[model samples]
Target: MRKFNLVFYFSGGGQFACEIEAEDMATAGSIAESLELRLSGCKGYDLYVKKEDK
Candidate 1:
């Protein structure tokens, strides 16, 4: 398993970020997608996932 940093770039001018644990970066991205859909509401946003540095 690995740690990932999830960043959501919202269109409205603010940002949301969090850390999650997943087997790989892809899994982390999937998790981010779910979060984006549910959390972003009607606002547009871009999701980005990066592996956490040791």
Candidate 2:
């Protein structure tokens, strides 16, 4: 399984970012949903995951 970094941004004012190490996109989605917070945008990257493994 592969890991991913999920970044979530909120609409209130500042940024609400979380680095979630998940096996796949589905797991990341579930985790994001559990937050129950209002987010303006979301982005995922594999770069951090690769670097972390190094």
Candidate 3:
């Protein structure tokens, strides 16, 4: 699994961000989308996969 950082932006103001562990980006995006729908005034979200140290 990999670590993903998700940032959700709202139309009404404020933001929601978290770091989650997931198998892949697709799964992370799905989770983020689900959260967005559950929260009111969510405009969209950005997904970032954390880079592992060498």
Candidate 4:
């Protein structure tokens, strides 16, 4: 299994991340769902928070 870094984001604020062993990034989706976390979406690596400024 290869090491994939997954990051989960929240609408309110902040993010969560974990490194797991998986065959591919797509397969890791189930792992994220199994955790039962409130997620806007799985975002890129280190983008922890954001909102529309304009």
TM-score per candidate, in order? 0.68, 0.47, 0.84, 0.49
TM-score of 1: 0.68
Q: What are the per-model numbers of colliding residue pairs?
A: 0, 0, 0, 0
For model 3, the local distance difference test gives 0.89
Question: Candidate 3 lDDT, tens digit per residue, 1-54?
Answer: 999988999887789888999898889889888898998888998999987879
- Which has the greatest TM-score? 3
What are the runs in model 2 whose C-alpha is more than 4 Å off? 37-54
lDDT score of residue 19 within candidate 3:
92
Runs of candidate 3 exceeding 4 Å displacement: none
Q: What is the lDDT of residue 3 in candidate 2?
A: 62
lDDT of residue 37 for candidate 3: 93
What RMSD does each model have against the real structure?
A: 2.9, 4.9, 1.4, 10.3
lDDT of every predicted structure (CA atoms): 0.67, 0.53, 0.89, 0.54
Best candidate, lDDT: 3
Judged by TM-score relative to the true structure, which candidate is superior, 3 or 4?
Answer: 3
Candidate 4: tens digits of C-alpha lDDT, residues 1-54? 656666666555668777766565555656656553444454434321222257
lDDT by residue (tens digit), candidate 1, 2-54: 77766676666677777788887678778877777887433543444554568
The alpha-carbon deviation from the true structure for residue 50 of candidate 4, after best TM-score superposition, in angstroms, is 23
Report clash pairs, candidate 4. Answer: none
